[model samples]
Target: MIRALALAVALACPGTALAQAGLDALDRRSELLGWEAVGRLDMPHGTCTATLIAADVVLTAAHCLHGLDADAPVRFRAGLSHGRAVSERQLAGWVMPERYRTDRGALERTESVGLDVALGRLDAPISTTDADPFLVLTDEARGDALSVVSYGRGRLDAPSRQGTCRIRQRFTHEVLGFDCDVTFGSSGAPVFARQGRRMRILSVVSAGDGVRAFGPRVAGRIAPLQAALDRDVPAPASTTGIKRLRVGEGRAGASGARFVRPERSP
Candidate 1:
C-alpha cells in the first residue's frame, strides 16, 4: 500500500536538503564498511530495503512481497552500491504476518502497517566477513537518537543513512512514528537505535506520509516472524509470474496516503 512520495515535502523540510540533516550517502567503501548488513530486497513484484538480522535470514516489509508467488524466487543484495554488492543470496522461502492480506484495500489499512513485516530464508548463509548481521532491539523503549539506512528511490544504487533522527512518537499498538527522511524504495529499511557507535535494529520501514514515517514497533513483531520461519516449508511449484515493482513503485495510489490509526495522546 505504500507508494512513492514527491520529494517536495522532504525538500521543503526545515528549508534545507537531506544532506544537511545528516543524511550521508554511503557511496564509498569506508562509508559503507560497517553497514554491510543492510541490503536491497529484490522481489518479482518490487524492490524494498532489507536488513540481514541473521546469517541466513532477512527482515523486510510485507508489502514488498505483495502478490509474490509461492515458487517465486527473490534475491537479497547486501550493501549494494554503484551496481556492486558486498554479497548476494537467493531466497529459499519467506514468512509474513498471518493477519496480512493482499486484498484490494488491505495494504492501505492501519492493520497492514502494524503487521507490515516479513522474514525470508536465504538459500545459503552469508559469511561474516562479507556481512555481519545486526541485532534487533526487542523492547518498546523509544530512544531519542534513532537512525535509518535505506536504498530509497534515487539512491537505490547508493544507500544512504540519516545519522541524526528521533522518534517523534512512541509505539502504540505495535506502530511507531518517526521523523526519518524516507522515500519510495525505502520499504523494509531498518530503523536503528544508536548507543555510541553500536546500533540495534529498532524497526522496519512500512510507509511514510508527508508528515511522519510509520512502521511496526518491532519489539514484539520479530518473534512471530521468526516462529513462522522456524516452521518454514519449501517453495511450492506454481506458474504465477514473479512480478517485480521497480524502485518507488509501492505507493498506495497517486497520492502517498495510507491509513494510520490515531494513537490517543497521553
Candidate 2:
C-alpha cells in the first residue's frame, strides 16, 4: 500500500539512526516475512518477514504473494535471526483480496481493498518463547504509534548480514506516517504496535520509496484487506509445546544453502 505525502524532508535526518534501529529489531525481535519457494515452479521457496497475528496465522503484504500461483508453498519464519531460525511453519492456505493488483503506474497506488494485506494459515504452531503472535488493530489504536520491520538488502544507511529496518510512525484509520525508507524485500513485513507485554499487528508493509520517491499510500489500501483476512482466518487452533528450536542452526549443513542471519537495527 503506497500513498503520496508532503515532499518536505525532515530537518534531523535519522537515516543512520533509523538504520541502526532496523538492525536492532532483527537481532532482538521475532519478526516474520512472507517467503516463497525459489528455483523450480514446484520447488518455489524464498523468505520475507511478517508478524504473527494468530497462533497459526500471519499477516503480511498481499504483493508478496501476488505472482505466486495458488499451489505455491508459502512459509513464515518467526523470531528469525542470522539464519539461525526460531520457528518455521508451512502455510496451509493464503488469502489476498482481489483489489491488490498493480495499477501499472510509475507512482504505484495500492488499495487496502485487496493488494495491501494478506493472511496465511500455518501448517503447524509457533512457540511464544522468543516468538509469539501479535494482537489485532482496535479503534483506540487509530492514532497510535506503529513500527515497520523488514529484511531486505536495499539502500540501508548501514548494511548488516541480518538485513533489517524499522521506522516509527503514527497510524490513523486511513494512514500511517514517518520517514519513508524501505526496499523490495520488505514487502510483507508487519506494521506493529507493542503495548506493555503484548505486541499487536496494525498493518503489513505495503510500499515506501521504490526508486525515486519516499513513502507511498498504504493506509486506505490495507485496512479493508485486513478486514477480509479476519473473516477468512478466523482464529488459530491452540497447540501446546510448539518447538522452540531454530530451523537452520543444525540443518543448513545438510540443506547446502548458506544460512543468513537476521540483523538487528537500533
Candidate 3:
C-alpha cells in the first residue's frame, strides 16, 4: 500500500491495458452481501484490508503490522461498511514467513513483495453463519479473470468492488502482476479468481499503484506460513483469566481513527 515502497517494482515493466470493470462503492447493505469475510484490520497506527481464510484465521499483508514487533493481538472489524460492522474480534496471534521483513532497505528489494504476507489467529472464531471463509486455490494459476473488494484510502468507510481485473503476468515467480484499482488501505485485500462456481483466493495485494498492483502468489507458500504459526502457539495457560473490562473502552471521538495519511504503510 506504500506507493514509495512499491513504486520501485511498478516502474520496471509497463502494465497491460486491461479492461475496466468500475470500482463500485458498497455503501449500501445490498452491495455488501457475500463479502462478509472481508474485514478491516485496525492497528495502532493504521488500517488494512483482510480476509477470513478459515474459521479462526485471517490473511493479511505483513507490512500492515510494521509497528508491531511481537505477535500481539489487534482489532478486526468484520464486514465493516460505512460506520458499523457485523462482528468485531481480536487477532490473538500473528505469524509471518522467515523471509518477511519490515526494514526500510529490505522492503526495497524485489522479493519483498512475495514475502509480504501474514496470518492472524483470531482469539475467537467467526461463525460460519456470520461469514463463510474463502478457500485458497493453491493448485493452479491458469485463471486470468480477477476481482477485488477492499477498503481504500478515499473510501475508508465503505468498501469498493472492482468486479473485473486481469492478471497481466507473473512479475516474479512468487509475485502476480495485476491491473486493479489498488490504493492505500487496499493492502492485504484478497485478489479473488473465479474457480468453477465459487471464488477462490489467489493472492494478497502486496504493492502497486492504482493502475497496476502486485500480489504474492500463494501456491506452495501457505504451508510455511501455517507452520510458523503452529510453532508460535502458546504452550499452555500460564496465568489467570483476569482482564480489565473497561480499559481504553471510553467514549472516544473521531480523533481515535488514526488511519488517515496512510503513506506509512510498509
> Which candidate tops TM-score?
3
Shift of residue 62 alpha carbon in model 2, Å: 0.2
Please write out the lDDT profile of model 2 over residues 115-148, one tens digit for every residue: 3456666676665443444545453454344445
lDDT per model vs. reference: 0.69, 0.43, 0.68
Off by over 4 Å in 3: 1-21, 71-73, 102-104, 234-266
lDDT of 1 by residue, 181-256 (tens): 8877788889988544457788887766665677777667777777778677433233233222211133134332
Model 3 steric clash pairs = none
- How high a TM-score does candidate 2 get? 0.57
TM-score of each: 0.76, 0.57, 0.77
lDDT of 1 at 4: 26
Q: What local lDDT score does residue 52 receive in model 1, on the 0 to 100 scale?
A: 83
Each model's RMSD to truth, in Å?
Answer: 12.4, 10.8, 11.1
The reply for model 2, stretches above 4 Å from the true place, is: 1-25, 28-46, 101-115, 140-145, 154-173, 194-198, 210-266
Better of 1 and 3 by TM-score: 3
Clash tally, candidates in order: 11, 44, 0
